[model samples]
Target: MAYTISDACVSCGACLDSCPVDAIKEGNPYTIEDTCIDCGSCEDTCPAGAISAG
Candidate 1:
């Protein structure tokens, strides 16, 4: 499974660089691409707690 970004995301770009595989993309609430490795890096770095296991 991969991580999904929720509406709670603040678009702060906190989870951007945290993605080891560069699966996270910049957007309104940010997005996780299919390349996600499910490492939970983005989720851990999300300040708004918007990322979760999908």
Candidate 2:
């Protein structure tokens, strides 16, 4: 499954540059697209703990 950003996201933009597949979109919580490869990079970069496997 792909990783998703939750409501806890602070829009800190931490996960933006971390996505190797470039599947994450800009927003409040941010949006992970289907192109996500589940690399867990964004999950680790998210400071708000908003990212998780969906």
Candidate 3:
């Protein structure tokens, strides 16, 4: 499964820099693209616990 950033995201930008594939976009809640490698890097870096496998 791929990882997704939820509404709980704080727009902290933590996950943005952690994505190796640059799949995360900045917004109220970051969005992960289909190109995501599902490496869990963003999930591990999210400070708000807003990222999860979907």
Model 1: CA > 4 A from native: none
- Residue-level lDDT for 27 in candidate 2: 85
What lDDT tens digits, residue by residue, belong to model 2 across residues 1-54?
Answer: 868789998998889899888999998768999899889999998889999987
Clash-forming residue pairs, model 2: none
In candidate 3, what are the lDDT values of residues 1-54, reduced to their tens digit? 978788899999999899898999888777888899989989888889999998
TM-score of 1: 0.91
Candidate 3 yields a Cα-based lDDT of 0.89
Better of 1 and 2 by TM-score: 1
Residue 23, candidate 2: C-alpha displacement in angstroms: 0.4
All candidates' lDDT scores? 0.86, 0.89, 0.89
Could you tell me the lDDT of residue 36 within candidate 3?
95
Sort the candidates on lDDT, descending order: 3, 2, 1
RMSD of each: 0.8, 0.9, 0.7
Q: Give every collision pair in model 1.
A: none
Candidate 3, residue 36: Cα displacement in angstroms equals 0.3
| Candidate 1 C-alpha lDDT tens digits along 1-54 | 867899999999889878888888888878888998888988888888899996
Q: How many angstroms is residue 24 displaced in model 2 relative to the true structure, after the best TM-score fit?
A: 0.4
